[model samples]
Structures are given as C-alpha cells and as structure tokens.
Target: MEVPSSEELLQFLSSCLSQIKWRLKSNSKRRLEIDVLALCTGMRPVVMIDYGGKMPELQNRLLSLLELIREGLPVFKDLKVMVIEDMIYLINVRSLPKFVSSSLDSEPELFFIDLEQDPPKMVTQSKESNLGMQLRSIQKLFSSTFPLDDSNTDTTTVLDEANSSQTSLCIDLSCCLQDTKVTIPTLNGWLLDYPVVYLFGTDHIEEAIYNLSTKSLRLFKVLVCRNGTTEKDSHLEELTSAI
Candidate 1:
C-alpha cells in the first residue's frame, strides 16, 4: 500500500469537510457549521465532529461522506463511522481496538456502521468491559513507578487508589514533562507542540485531569482552553497551525 504524503492527506480531508458543508447547506437550508476536531495516532486519522444536537441529519450526511471517502481514497477505504449522541467519529477500522482500549471510565455508546453492506448496517457492542481494559492499561503503565500491592488485586480498589493519589502522581511526573517530546499527529504529519485541551464543562475538566494523570508517563501534554474569547481563539489558532 502506498502511504499518502502529508499534503495529499490534508487535501483529501479538506475536500471531505467541504463536501459535508455543501450537503448541510443544500439539505438543511441553514448555514449550520459543525466543529471538527482532528487527531492522528501515527498515520491513522481520527476525525470527530460535533453535530450540535442535529445528529440525525449529520449522521446520514456523514454516512454518505464515508461512502464517498471509501470510493475516493483507497488508503481510508476501511474507515469506520460512529455516532454517539451529538458527536460523530470517523476513524480507520484497524485503529478502533487501540482507540477503545485507551479510553477511560465510561466508554461512549459506540454505534459502528458496516459500510460494505447494502445501505450500511449498524453494529452495537457492549461497553461494559471498556473500563476494565482501560484500568489494566493504566496499571501496566504505572507498575514500574508505583508497584501494585500483590494482595489487593481488585480493579475497583486499584482505580480508587489511583484517583486518590492523582495529585501526587502528577507532581512526580511534572519533572518528566520537560524531558518528554510530545507531538500530536495531524493529517499533514506530526507537529511538536503542547497538547490542545478543550473544556466543555465541569465534566470535561475532570476527564482532562483523569487522562493527564494516567497518561503522563506516556508523553501526555496539554494546554487547557476555557470559553474566554482570547483562550478559545488561541486554541483554534493552535489547531490550525498544528494541522
């Protein structure tokens, strides 16, 4: 398989976004622009869209977009489309397992569409084991630094301990941040910068903390953005530069 150059990847994604926007304006008769957040793990691209409570309409549009992508971009033919509430996630199917395993706490209710089928069919899976997988991954990361007690092997108990000592763990890991070279991969390739953090509310703040605390050992870096005009604009600017 041929790997797409950074410029090629970016151009493809730009075309996809433009197509989505055209569809929205033509079908909905409104200029409703969805916010997009793009992330990449190595060469794999994950595109997240905030549908702004217009999920039903966006979901159908995204499904058509997925089909278009499969036909246009052979590199991303196996990309999976998922809708959880108002958020729509488009990621390569091969990357799904790793993405799901890295998620913390309550996993999003993932509804994956089988694009190969006629009209595409939705496949729903149980999210019950997501927490367990996340916890185990965390345990492995922390095992060398904070050895787990052999006697207390319960997952819940381990999670409670980690939560309680989150502050101390962060303090200890602060020194390593300076030495770590964290870069977020983009459609245009990797860019070295502080990680961009978006806080929607109190819930998002907690989620940010949990992720940073647990993943600090693995080159976790972040710059928090509130709703303030300056900060929000700066975050968008940073995203633009990164991409």
Candidate 2:
C-alpha cells in the first residue's frame, strides 16, 4: 500500500476537521475531532483521549466521526476505537510500519496539533521527555495485544496470522462496537464462501459463529468449526473428515 505524503495527509485532515467543525454543534465534540486528527495524522499507534466522565456522549460522537472516516477514507478502515475506563483509545494499526522500520531501542517522537493558531500547528515532542514514557507504555500495550514473533517478518505477516492452522484465535467483541444481528442472507453468503460448521452455545451462538466464520473467511479459505455443545469429539472428527 502507498503511504500518503505528509503534506497530502495534512491537507486531507484539514478538510476533514473543517467539515467536522461545521457539522458538530458542541465545542467539546469539535475538540474531539481535532484530537483525533492529531493522533491519526501523527501516526500514533495507541493514544488515550480523556472523555472527562462523559463517555456515553463522547462515544456517540466518536462513533459518528469514525463512520464518516470509514466511508470516505479507505486508508483508515482498519482503525479501531476502544473505550477503557474514562479514556478513549484510538489505535491505528497502520502506525506499526514506522515502529517496525525503526531500531528496537529508538524512541518514537510524538506529534500533537494545536488548532488555536492560524492554519493549525504541528508540535513534536522529543523522545527524551515525559511523553516518551507514555509512548513506551502505549507501545508495550500494543505489542502485548498483538505480539510479533519475529522482528524480521514483513508487516503483512505481523498483522495477518489467520492463515496458520495452528494459530488459536480469540475473537473479542468487547473491545469493539459491532452489529450482532445476523440475517439469513448473511449466513447463507458466508456458507457459500467457506466451509463453516456452527457450534451452538448456551448464549449468542449465532453471533459467535458469525464472528468466527466471517473473520476466518477474510484471511483464507479454511474450515471453521467450533464445538460448544456436548457433542463427542469423534463426531467432530468424522464431520471434518467427511467434508
């Protein structure tokens, strides 16, 4: 994928900020938009935004902004927003390129935008400062969540590990906001594309199966069969063999 030049990215972000300012009625919401632009363009992997105890309001505002970005910007489609305590975290997985390319001991410079000034201003925080500590913490969290087994591996290998049959995957929906309702057509579509065997559970079995099957389909054509019931292991073995 081609990365955008700094100037091009800034111009696009400026336009987005202007539109957000014009559309959002609340000052706080507009400020959130500015913060988001700062972090995203700054290429910070994970940074926390203080919601000031107004999580519900900020979450709705953030979701609206994310939807807008998702529809208009293909580059940020993989961006994930997570709420933890009073802080809202914006994780740009694309930022990993800069980290992966740099020396292991090198500290990353942090960027922030000051919109109070004319034309907006980009501020760079040195790696020697306190922000560096926070940056380290952010990197630690990111690395823990998505561990890289080999530093020499390409970015695609780092992010896309679903192709490995031995990889045990855990689909955590709590970290994200997703529509749980599954239609018959959607299920049929999934069934047509891949070999999926449903594993019914005590609760939300369809949603569970949908999440697993859909994510699996994105990586490669592989059989996704989960067992939540008391079915015998022999039965599952036979089913896979038959397929």
Measured by TM-score, the strongest candidate is: 1
Clashes of each: 0, 0
Q: What is the C-alpha RMSD of each candidate to the true structure, in Å?
A: 19.5, 25.1
Model 2, 1-243: lDDT tens digits are: 676553455456456646665344455443444444545564345445454236667665555556666666666565666543344556565564345334134444334322223333445434333333433343343344444453544323322442343212111212211222222222222212223322222234445445544442233322323234245532221111111
- lDDT tens readout by residue for model 1, 140-178: 433333333445334334344544544211112222112
Query: Candidate 2: lDDT over CA atoms?
Result: 0.41
By lDDT, the best candidate is 2
Lowest summed lDDT across 10 adjacent residues in model 2 is found at 234-243
TM value for model 2: 0.35
In angstroms, the error of model 1 at 33 is 14
